[model samples]
Target: MSNDFFSTSNRIKSTPFTSRNNMAGVKKYSVYNNTLIPTVFRSLKSDYFHLIKHVQIWDVCCQKVIEVRGNNALSLMKYLFCRDFSKIVSGKSYYAPIVNFEGGLLNDPVVFCVEKDHFLISLSDSDLFNWVSAINHTKEFYADVNETDILTIAIQGPKSEKLISKIFGEEIKFLKYFNFKKFFFNKESLIISKTGFSKQSGYEILLTNPNNGILLWDLIMEKGKEFNIKVGCPNMIERVENNLLSYGNEMTNKDTPYDCGLGKFCNLETEYEYIGKSSLLKQKQVGFEKDIFKIHFNYEFDDQPIFFNNLPVFKKGIEIGKATSIVWSPKYSKYIGFLIASKKIMNNLNDYYILDKGKFEVSEIL
Candidate 1:
């Protein structure tokens, strides 16, 4: 999460409603897209339980959106591999894995079809806007790419529906998962989507007017008082248990879509030409050696393994993989993590070790 003090700079930015986060007792912060995001409101352990039981408003403005306009917007989207965007219609959000020419992962973002020929690509941690802009630089596709001034706020948790209904009304029930609709609140239009990074069901509200951010946040907070709603951020423990992958933590530019276990979304065919079509096709035929898995570490309740960095995994002295994300799952009363391991090296019986540290139990992500 955060190291605390947030001083806005050119590179490290602050959102419009960042003051609200600080006022809400935000304890930690993480810089995403150059914006200071509240990673922890109270404490990870306490905030996590509250998030699952009640409701939380998250300042996710760091999750920026890249707007693409014109007739070739769909064509540009087609160039984004590991997903078929031809069938994607307006009002839907697709979890598309953006890949490069070498089939290496770029950014796994949700592409929102706002309207026909108008789309928004919500980014993760990376500066994918330049890459995307460069792709359409020649204007050959006739697609204009620009970063939107919009900011995002997420209402996540089990009680998220009830909290959102208090302001948005009961009609929100009709909004399906990965679906978004324009709603005007206090005369300000907001695109609300039934999607979030948490395992808990939630909605992400896209604020076009940055000035209206605090206004909207305050409105939700007031309505959320009944639901015991608290200001929150993405909990590492909850995400680890839920296997909700974070870009820089779970993956990087070196990893491919297949390595990330995103092959199911890769609809590779000769019909659609994308950046990584050839390499993905080759990997499809040759197969991937490394893949991601969920690991169950030593499960003693007192075994609070707090290694902040990744621990390498080995089988009989042969390096197999490493635990990319690790946490103590309070709900499970055990240590769990997402391991990026090689398939060939994973065939063993109780021989896995965290390098020279010690022996540990390994489990695959289901």
Candidate 2:
């Protein structure tokens, strides 16, 4: 492993569970949303297998919540993303891409409808608060936009439901996917939702008090002892295989929602108007010229692949696209990742070369 300099300061915040992570011997961290996110604890392959077979408690406080409350909260939401809010009933969450006026992706957040008028935008790694605040300031909307102190913790894996049920009761295990319910822990009410970034069966606890962070972590760890719970963050290999897209990793402000394969989430012809609706409609008419793909290598890689940015992909010695995310999957025994390619190459999911050497095959997100 190579040592990279990462400084700590007021700007880079640590979650309340940082100490616990330290105790767990967290090996590495990556910054997300100006917060320290644990990238590894044990070895990568070990952590990946643990996450697949057992349970993991992840300090996902970096998944910040931008709360929108008041009469015009729905109006602000309507103007922010392209999702049809009418379909998002209370106690449910909807994944939507927040775009700017030019149809460029600002952030892809999971909007949670907490109540009739109150909603929480659980954002990815982006400054969504500023955008919402600016919108509220310019318009005479009755919505209040502010970042909440609520820290998010995720319990994920095959055994997550059993472990959560041991503490929160069996009723919580029955909570439908994408639904949330308020539960009390030590007499403090906190929200737990059946939503997570991982494809594994899991729940994200939206903790209200930062003080309860370690307390909750301890309780879960204690109860989850039987299930062999591990302290792990999001696994790159698993996410790539599942085709989960990261915000800054897969798509950014430079790309539109259509470019990131988010067109299905957009309803351009809806009666409701949102920010970038016009741009999205125009882009829809023009159609997407570039998009993301999930690719698999023909041969195994001796070393795990980590891509911070795009890696040039070539076809017949000519650069055609760039890969955003890469990982060597132990489950599939293959190198798998996501890449952006032109419509011509993207339409034909076939053999290609990366780094002008390796043979690979690409496919749409399955």
Clashes of each: 2, 0
lDDT of 1 at 224: 90
Give the per-residue lDDT of model 2 (tens digit) for 246-328: 99888888788888788788888778778999887777787777787776664444554543345667776777767777776
The TM-score between candidate 1 and the true structure equals 0.94
Per-residue lDDT value at 210 in model 1: 68
The estimated TM-scores of all candidates read: 0.94, 0.93
Shift in Å, residue 288, candidate 2? 1.5
Highest TM-score model number:
1
RMSD of 2: 2.6
Model 2 regions lying over 4 Å from their true place = 1-5, 299-310, 354-366
lDDT tens readout by residue for model 1, 104-197: 8899998899887999989999999888988887537869899998899999999999888778889998899999999998797889999998
